[model samples]
Structures are given as structure tokens and as C-alpha cells.
Target: MIQEIKPAIWQILGKQPGRNVVIIGGTHGNERTGVEVVSKLKSMIESGRLNIIRGTLVLIHGNPRAIEINERGSEPHADLNRSYLVDLLEREPTGIYEDQRAREIAPLLIVSDVVVDLHATNKPSEPFIACADSSGHEQVYQWFPSKKVLSDPNYVLAGKLVTTDEFVDAHGGTGLCYETGQAGDVTRVDEVMRNVINLLIDQNLVEGEVRIPSNECEIYEMIEPIVLTAVGFTFAEGFGNGSWEPFVADQTIGYHGDVPLVATYDGVVVFPKIQELRKEGSPLAYLAKKVNERKKPPRD
Candidate 1:
């Protein structure tokens, strides 16, 4: 049976501990790839197919109730992933369900050496890794050879709770958001889950034979993520993953009515929203680079 810590943090502790690698899934409730992956890993360990090394592998089910309903909001209709900022916790305290969940998991993350949070997008797109502008970026990039890397330099928004890239930077450990594919797609989920498990083993977090991808996938270094607000409207209905070609220098992609939401620099689109939600704004898209093209790729 899976072990529970409070209502959000769950773990399957190994026989011994040395280094610690935390794998978090279902942070968004609807995105279930990481959850399934963790479950499978636990089964392997219990059945003696996989072995724990010098470190402990902790599988955190981010939002259990949300996963059960397959919606972004947990039981209290809060986005758990965006609930990590310290101020938010102190202010409202129990304003949202995600806030409470963050309180429970923050301490657990503080002690981890490496954290990988798995996610699935609403639109179909290739798998990629997201990291903050911190030393950990180098480590995580080298750990999981992705086709692209999304590096955001902005101060992480306080609203994003537990798995924010900022927390990883603050703690001096590598933190990554692995976007697998469209929500609830088992095929894509399996592909990402297998990759994550293999990544842990390859990085020496666990003791097992895990295959790392031979060819690195495309890498996208996000210079900036255009945040949507009430005033602007993303050109809906036509946008889908890989729908548009990589933006050319100073090319326009969308408009706030007449104002152009152009690409200041050229890169591929990563997360384009297709579904409607309660929130007015969403990530319009991201700029990225192919991994091989980077001047200096992230290293261990």
C-alpha cells in the first residue's frame, strides 16, 4: 500500500537512505502522468524489479483529490501548483486548499537534493523541461537530456505553491517541471513516466538499469513568458501545440485587439492554452531553442 504524509505528501520509503530524489505528480490534479509513473515505480520496488541505491526516492502525489476528479482545482477548487509563495501562506493561511497542501510539502522539499514534478498540458506538444534561472538548472538539464530547455529569469510568482522552480533555486537543488503531453492521454503519460523513472536511475538517484535518451530532444530557453490578463485575448480556437512555425525575429503571433503580441526573439511555441478556465489569463506561448544550438548547454 502507498504511504501517506498528511493529505498531500505521499512517499514509498526505501529500506535505507542516502541522497534523496523527490518525484511529484498530479500537482495540477488533472495531469496524471507523474502519479501513474510513481505508482509503477513503487510496484517495481516492492516486486524487487527496481532497487534503491544510497538515496531515498520519494514519490509525492501533489493533489490526490484533483487527480480523482481529473480537474485542475483540488477539492477546494485551488490550483496547488501556484500556491508556493511564503507570503501567501502567512496572509490568507487557509485561503485555498493548495495553500494548506503547500504548507505540508514545503518542509519535505526543503531537504531534497533533486525534485522532479511531472505535468501534462491541455494541448498536445512535445515533452520538455522547465527550470528557473538558478544553478539547479544546469544539474536538471544534464540529468534529463530534453529536446529543449525553458529557462525563466523572472521572480517566480508567489501564487505558485510547492513545485515552483524558485523553491528549487532557493534550496540549492535542481527542480524541474516536466510537461509530458495532453491531459489524461495514457500513451503520452507512459512515455513521460518511463523517461522520469529512467532519469532518476541514470542520475544515480536510484539503483536500477534505466535507459537515457541517446539523442537530446529540442531545447527551448524561454526568454520571457507572456502572461495573459483581462485586457488581452489570446487568439483562441486556432491555437494548438506545434500549430505555428518558430517565430521569426520581431514577428507577430497574436494581438490584444489591434496591438500586436509579437515575438521579440524567435523560438518555438511550448504551452498554448486550448481549454477555457476560471482564470482570465494563461500562458500564451513560450520561446525556446533546440538543445544542440545552445552556446553552453546545462551540465552536471
Candidate 2:
């Protein structure tokens, strides 16, 4: 059963001894993939269809109020994912929903040995993993079984944004942000559940053999985010998420009315969300350059 320690936060503990792992979903209320997966897992466990042989597993719904309204955030221009700023971990009242929620959720990271922060893009795309510079700890992504692991990009980590995955990592735990798929896609729930189950098995939290994917995982580096800061920003071509086409310098991918938002360097346009209306300072898309074909390396 799911117990509510606080509003919007829920945890479930397994029967046996193991590491403490936490997985979060619904950081953006509109992203239903994580939330659905958590709920489904809860049912599966209760019905004896799945078992957690060891370790405690915590599943959290990051933005319950927003999910209640079926919007990205409950209020206009609100973002819950970026609310984990370091200074705000004090748990003091922040006067903002996302900020206050972040404070309430901070304690979970303290006990987490592994953290999986799940997310879904506004535009449809293939699943991927967003990890920090894990040069020394490169084996983390092998568990999640994603072909593409994205690292730093253009203007990556440029602002004061502190994500949930980063916070859990700060506590000396393994943290990863998994982008399941597009928000409204029906298959994202299964994708999120499958990858998370693989993580659990690889970590020995569950008693099962891991199913390795046939395709090799690849790594990419995000170089730039096409920011839609102006009122009239619109895509030149309606690009879906994960649309990686060759882009040249000064090529107009979109426009702020008549003003072209051109690429400054050569790369592929990725995670483009051209179908929705976005607030200023939000990303219209990101450009990524392929770093390499990810390979298993000798352990240090």
C-alpha cells in the first residue's frame, strides 16, 4: 500500500532487506507516464503479480495538485521540476507551490540510495536518459537500458536550475532523470515501467533476471536549447520531439514572428515542441551533437 507521509508524496516499502530506492513521477502534472507507472506497480504488487524481494522502494508523485488539474502546473507558468534549488531545501515556506513542494520533498533524498526521476516531454520522442557528467560512474546507464544517454549541451546547466536527480545525487546516491516519452502517448507507461523494472533487477532489489535490449545504447551531448523567450515564437517546421535532422549554422529552425531563431553551429535538432503554446524562458527545442556509440568499458 502507498502511504502518504506528506501531501503529494507517497512511499511503499518492500518486505526484505536491501538498498533504499526512490522513483519520482508527475513532477510536471501534465506528464502522466511516471504517475501511471507508479500506480500500476502498486496494483501489481498488491495483486501478487510482482514482488519486491528486498530493499525499500519509494514512488512519489511530485506535483499532485497539478496532476489533479491535468495541467503542466496547477497555476499558470509554474514549473515543479526546476523547484529543487539548493538554498530552498530549508523547508521554509516559499510562497510558491512548486518551491514549497520542493521543500517538502527534500527529505526523501536524504534516505534514498538510488533515485530515478521520471519525466515526459511535451512533444513525442523516443525514450532517453539525461545524466550528469558520469565519466567515472559510467555504468549507471547500463542498468536503465537506454541507447541514448545525454550529457551537457549548449547552455547546459547555465542557470540556477537544480533538478530532482541532481539533489538525490548530492546526497551521495545514484540519480538519473529518465525521459519516458511524450506526455499523452499511450505507450509511455509501459516504457517507463519496463525500464524501471530493469533498474530494480540490476540493483538486486527484485529477484529476476534482467532483459538486455538487442540494440546498443548510444551517448549524445546536448549543446543548445532553442529558448522561446518572445511572444511570437513559432517553429519554421513542425518538428516533433526526437526529430534529429542535420542543421547548419544560420539555418532557421523557427522564428519569433519574422525574426529567425537560427543555429549558431552545426548539430541535430532534438526535443522540439512545436505543437504547444509555451511561456517565455521555456525551451522550444534543443540541439544535440552525437558524442559516440556507447560501449562497455573495462571497470576501474
Residue-level lDDT of model 2, residues 23-84, one tens digit each, is: 88888888888888877877777687777778887878888898899787769767777777
Off by over 4 Å in 1: 75-77, 86-92, 133-145, 156-163, 203-205, 209-219, 225-245, 281-283, 286-300
Candidate 2 global CA lDDT score: 0.72
Per model, how many backbone clashes are there? 20, 6
Model 2 TM-score, all chains together: 0.85
| Candidate 1 Cα deviation (angstroms), residue 189 | 3.9
- Taking all chains together, each candidate's TM-score versus the true structure is 0.80, 0.85
Our model 2 lands, by Cα RMSD against the true structure, at 3.0
Cand. 1 TM to true fold:
0.80
